[model samples]
Target: MEETAGDHQACRERPAASHLSWAGDGPETRSGLALGHHRPGETPMSHHLRTLAVVGSACAISATLLSSAASAAPGSPGPARVDAAGDATALKRPAWTRLRAEHSKKCVEIPGWSKRQGVRADQWSCVKQANMQWALWLVQAPGAGGVRHHIYAIQNRNSGLCLTVDAKRNGSSVTQRQCRNKKYGDNYTKQLFWYTPDNRFFSQYAKGKCLDIAGASKRNRALTTVWKCSYAKNQRFKNIK
Candidate 1:
């Protein structure tokens, strides 16, 4: 479902976010209003928490609303939704983002800020730290063979390495490695990935396999691995907040 010009009125009954400088009609006027939504099965981020500590920028929040006013796309519910942390524009730019696994509600982090290859990925309590953020870089090889889905190199803000999967099989370990592609420079299939409408991250190493939380455990420090895509909560992740 997408939102258009009328979405601004969809939440007329709900009060606007606190400290909003203005309550008017356009982004040009810096008056654009935006709303956020939680995916099915996920807890709705509380507005109270957002007001207490906003995580995104004013430009991002406003631009998102105005952008949606002119366009619509799947997974794009309205202008742009700001979760408890901030505006939902994780992949809109080649920016570093925080990915939270749905089932555990934890942010993916490179344990201990290790900068070496083959370090397995882990999910931990969400925190405002560099290790928790990942920078997404699009792999541009339009007609490359073995390519079936849009791919992006998921790089960690702290480790400066791309997320890499060991093999194209279920139970394969997903680790971090230096981004290098002999044919396409940081476009190596094993280091590339794509997300589906179901919110699962599939590595180019195998479209059938998704980034999964080991054992579906909600405990902090649960390791992440590649598993057959099941659309299960453990495999679902969102780059919001």
Candidate 2:
């Protein structure tokens, strides 16, 4: 299909409810650590001093942990604590968890999956199929290869009345050839699913394409289609916890 934004028109669904518009505060107020507006007499020096204090405290804690870990043997509790730091960082971001919650809350459950054999299909009562249930995750293949080598398109198989099962897509992009089955088969509908947790923050997976913000609002009616992977930040969807 033609590449345009808003290609998700066919699947009926609400707008604001699915999308969170978080710009993460502008550059001037990016940190969001300040109290109310500053008083006229307060010197800029104070802010610098406070910032340095916070940084120093964090460094000191890190240094202490590192020093302890250095003294410990290879298989020691100290190493475990150091390792936890990495996991903790990932846990701090509730992206995927939020997405799952939203899917359960906003997505309408469609039943009738068994009839289509390997395929699945479902409709959401609250959110549009496109917004809630009709999307896929694009992941990087593990190994040394170009961007296309690691990119994959994964989506649930929809057949008959049931929606979603186990089916995945592996390729640089969408395939033009359609699969036909004498008994029952479906041509990829080319619908992308935007799994969002908190609204603005979302992780999207396309059957053969990636979501592009610049084109989203413009061509709203265009059907979903595959496009070159630009790896745009908008395409980087976060899964909400």
Candidate 1 backbone clash number: 0
Candidate 1 clash pair list: none
lDDT of 1 by residue, 74-186 (tens): 44211122111122134354666899999989999999988877899999999988888886665543455665655566777776776888887788888887665545433
lDDT of 2 by residue, 1-241 (tens): 2322232231123222211222452233545543233335766666556555544554456555556656664542121121212223222222112112122232222233232233222222343332233222233333534432322222222311111212233222221121211122222223223333223211123343443223322222212222334444433434322
Score candidate 1 by lDDT.
0.68
Displacement of the residue 240 alpha carbon in candidate 1, Å: 1.8
After TM-score superposition, what is the CA distance of residue 49 in candidate 2 from its true location, in Å? 99
Candidate 2's C-alpha runs over 4 A off are: 1-141, 144-153, 160-214, 218-222, 231-234
What lDDT does candidate 2 reach at residue 86?
Answer: 24
Q: How do the predictions measure up, each by TM-score?
A: 0.57, 0.22
The weakest ten consecutive residues by lDDT in model 1 span 77-86
